[model samples]
Target chain A: MLKDGRVFVIPCSGIGKALGTVGRAAMYEVVEKLRPNEATTICLPLLTIGDEAVLKLARNNPCISVDGCPFQCARKNIEASKGKLVASFMVTDVLRENKDLKPKAVTELDPKGLKLASILAEKLATQIDEINNNNR
Target chain B: MAIVKDKVGVVSCSGEDLPEGTISRIATRIVLEKLRPNDTVTICLPLFLAGSEDERAFARVFPTIAIDGCDKRCAEVGTKKYSGKPVATIVVSEIMQKYPYLKAKSRGKLSAKEKELALKVAEEIAAKVDEVLERKKRGDSN
Candidate 1:
């Protein structure tokens, strides 16, 4: 179980496309590998379904939503559940910034897709660090 | 029948209201990571419902299994609505009815019985994957 006061990382549960997969991959990289101690994951669907525990967690802590596309499901759901969103990242914006790194597949990421996820993860980790430092 | 070069797609409702949703998610992971690693892929239902052309296109081309948490059948309904009908559908409610002895205890985390039930569902899905792929292979041979 996630403790209180830690930054909640919400990744868009968009498993349908490459961009969504990239967003999920980057989110895991940040929460599990990069800042495991400072941040934890809140399942996005739980927020949508009105899970009180998940909603309470979002309400109490600062959240970072990583959205895969323009629909902004993660961001919208987090806010709808009354959570405080400190920052948000869009995988499309990352692709736009690095035009050459086009993802090859949706289900399984290719080298470029993995690279894109790494780049996004790095950026998200930096934001998490900033939030953690500010709170301290 | 043209041979499909890609693997089957696994779409789970991952619903939050019930432990069944958690089961669907974990069961999907079991199939993707353990049971049929190279033969299956994941399709994100949120993006598909939100109008992703890539997701729709992939679903249209590949065989898919929809693992739904409840009778709401969001994953199954969404897949059928936007793309083609799912090759296989697994509903947790039906699974519970089939095996009344196995009850999921928690929505946040699966208990031992819940994990076992989830694995049972995963094995069922794996078998479905084989069935779909085999049918496609047979079609290609004809």
Candidate 2:
């Protein structure tokens, strides 16, 4: 385990839309690429199941919720588990801003979907830094 | 309320740690979108376990097919916990056992082999959907 103070990036695994897959891809980009040391993720389903270790990790650190739809399952799960949410993103809202990016597939992202995820990942990385600055 | 006669709830676990988890998710989408578009609706597992009353209600009332990635079976467990027992459960690991060559490695993007495996799994889920729907009179679409 990397030392304490990592942000938990919770992405909604909503299978209904391509946007949710984009959110998941964006999450992987943030934790695995953009801010590897600063951010980590636990499956949202694990948090909902009250997995003790996952709950501890979530509760101990700041969380960023990336939800695909308005239902906001990721954010609500964090709140339900009493995890601190430092930032929340709606993939639909992001797509609105970057209208050129279109995610077409749910299984694996197409070129445009990967681009959208990168955009979202870059935004989350920036926010994590800003949050760190504020905390300091 | 009563179980919806026409629709089945498909709850697929989102297991991020393993590639099988990814297969479970992608396969679910294929079944919902490509294979059984009109007959199945997705029940987001995260929302379901997070005490979304509507999700719970749907699983409780509708014929639910829980698709899980690993032996842990989060989807099956969650559906059984909040709602009634799922009408059926599909585990990807078990399915993988039947065809060893269809192994998937990446969680982010699927290879062609992985896509084929996902299609096979999707077909399995679609079959289950048809079974639960009791569609003996109707012809299978794909």
Q: Give DockQ per model, in order.
A: 0.14, 0.53
For residues A27-132, write the lDDT of model 2, one tens digit per residue.
8888878888888887777777777887888888899999998889899889988888889999998899989898888767889988999999999999999988
Q: lDDT of all predictions, in order shown?
A: 0.78, 0.84
lDDT of 2 at B44: 83
Regions of model 1 farther than 4 Å from truth: B1-11, B14-142
* Consecutive 10-residue window with the lowest summed lDDT within model 1 chain A: A42-51
Cα RMSD to native, each candidate? 8.0, 3.7
Error of 2 at B121 (Å): 1.7
Residue-by-residue lDDT tens digits, candidate 2, B1-142: 7777788889988887678888999999898878999999887887775545766787767778999888878888877877768878999999998889999787877889999999999999999988988842353322
- Model 1, residue A32: what's the lDDT? 64
Q: What lDDT is reached at residue A66 by model 1?
A: 88
